[model samples]
Target: MSIHRLIVKSAALLTAGIAIGALLAGAAAAQQKLSFLAAEYSAKTLPFWEQVVADFEAANPDIDVTLEVVGWNTIHDLTAQRIAAGTMPDLVNTATIWVPEWVDAAAIRPLGDDLVDATLRADFVPALFDKGAVYNGENWGLPIAAAARAILLNKGLLAQAGFDPDAPIATWDDYRSIIVGVKEKTGAFGYAFDAKGVRAFRDFGYYLLNNGGTFFAADGRAAFNSPEGVEALQFLVDLVKAGAVPDPLGTTLEDYQPMYEAGRVATMINGNFAIAGIKANAPGLEIAVAAVPVKTAGQTPVTWGVTDTLVIGKAAPVEASRKFIAHIFSTAVRNQFDEAEGMLPVLLSQAGNPAFTGDPNIKAFIDMLPTSQFDPFHPQYAQMQELVKTAMQSAITGAASPKDALDKAAADFNALVK
Candidate 1:
């Protein structure tokens, strides 16, 4: 073998090695595709999600993303079916209320410091990230929007009832008086309550929180059976007994909409989403939105301000999903998505963006983020809501005392958590 023969062999081997490496890299890139099943965006024209995907793909050409928007009503069924089949999407815009249960079911993975750096954590509203996304002390997802339930009161009714339209309702006693006054002056139900079903839990939840109580105690025991809980339920029962609020054993807000529209309901409690609906139902109706009245004076305002969260499934490629999470949450994309969805921006700096500032109703909800508390993130949350409803109805219908009804609910809650 001469020097020329050796040199030709070495060059041929090097060229083959380079070509093989390129082929491997292209194959790896092709395999880096992510499937995201989301709700709400799947049907929108010019969806903000599509824009986010396009921007992400532009910045990251090597990764492919598939977005499937499922309808809000059907997404839960789809998620359950997919999870049962072990075919959950790589990323899912999880039903915020169910994220904890998903974590418990081993459907999603808990994100760690490696995947969520300080900068990424800091990008979201601190309280939202801290309250809405954490489950059992672990950060399990990211909240994309923030909204809270507030009180919508008709100023005209307040004035007619000899109450100052500008004065905010602060205590249960005062709220009761207003309810009575409205009934006396206008002969209309002062409060339109949705107390007939599971949603009844939320209507009473206002009283529970304002009284400085929680569903579960620090020891992980069901504690709403305590005095605070009794006070809350007793108040509702008293209202129904006094005929200030009609029997609300199985009704929901939609049922009360007609009453609200007819000017027969003085105050209704609901979330930011209700503003547009109320306007559409009665375009001439004038109302004021404020933090729900507290159980007592001098208590800090509190309401369940929820955020829509996206979580990565356990079967998803963690690295790719993480990169997508980071990309989708970039300030530009986040602000735009929130604006289009009529949601508050997750970032603190965007608090004053005219996009959010222009809507006073949304602003009231946004200003509440600081004082809001996310509902308990537990697998038993739905059951808990039902149990609370049963207890409330039993008390309101005179089937049991407040303490007795709540005691039974505590037993049920304890059994579920057990």
Candidate 2:
């Protein structure tokens, strides 16, 4: 071979080697590590979350995801600790109300337009997707499941107590009367009150709202000790004192699930997402969705709505995180998750379907959306929740009189609300 031809051949080989090395490097760089820290989901819907994680990782071999589910009761405190230590997860599944506090601390990033695409966004129920997730004009989270509070009544229990199974429970007086009657005749706890853990405040808030009370007054200070607030707390204490409810100081709804399954709990305050659980665990038990009993006669029946969201930290790998989120919210994925979770699908394409509208219990929850108000937004929402939780637990446990507990909660709230 000629010397010139040999030299050219060596140069070509060198170039090819360099090109191969560069391609390998690029492939490695494309691989992303994304961590998702989510609060614990219900038994029925938890597997779906695991499935989504597996599916996303499978479809995108270039990306890796770490899924960690934390106990709901400790998520708030744990998330704060993680963020303070600069170890906040790339993505977090959190309750909707947490957004304001997260935003105030600059912990969460605004989702890019692709993740919050117009077409996909347009599919959600307007009030939920459009209003709930939007903060300061840009979207911050992907709403996953929407739930409305309701009174879960075991209809068979009502019949045995001589109450009309078909009658809608209206006033709180009637609610308590039924509770006492159920206790007297059946020797079972008439109510299962979750006065412990993160659920305490929201569970007790039903009474606060029914009594026409507000959490914060006009100037954004704690006003929950109003006559209505006092009334709400008193009822909680009364139920415990009257032995109409199980001791609720240190327990959650989960602790009473077996009771409900055994038909020992006549009624409880829970979200509509519990309907499927009731049917699945205690089959053939007649059930009804009653209006959350109100305090005043002739008052409008009302309930609160809560939405959970998928949040991305500001320091996250935005591109990859956005892709994973968009994938899970695709029409098929969101619908399946919502159905299994017993929550209202945020998307109209799913929520508007007859599948949700046709069921009377589901329909009752849906109808509440129009009047379902999220608690007023505040930067100290997490702290406020804790304060209110303490008041509920203390009152129900008889550690403090209802007035003392509520008044203290109001005072503690003032320190933060300012």
Against the true structure, whose lDDT is highest?
2
Worst 10-residue lDDT window, candidate 1: 39-48
Models 1 onward score TM values of 0.83, 0.87
For residues 360-401, write the lDDT of model 2, one tens digit per residue. Answer: 888878877887876566677777788988988788767888
RMSD of candidate 1 to true structure, Å: 7.0
Cα lDDT tens digits, model 1, 1-418, are 9999999999999999999999998788676889998778323424777878888888887788998887766777798888899898988886688897788779988877656677888867778787776877787888866668888888788888888766777788888999989998889889978777546888878888888878888766788888999998888888888888766975677688678877889888877756666777788877787677778788777877767788888878867787898887877777777665656688776766887788767777777777888877667777878888889888987899999999999997888786
- TM-score between model 2 and native: 0.87
Model 1 per-residue lDDT at 142 = 84
Give one clash count per candidate, in the order shown: 4, 1
**Deviation in angstroms for 153 in model 1?**
1.2
Which segments of model 1 are wrong by more than 4 Å?
A: 1-31, 41-64, 71-74, 113-118
Worst 10 residues of 2 by lDDT: 40-49
CA lDDT of each prediction against the hidden true structure: 0.80, 0.81
RMSD, each candidate, Å? 7.0, 4.5
Q: Under the 3 Å rule for N, CA and C atoms, how many clashes does model 2 have? A: 1
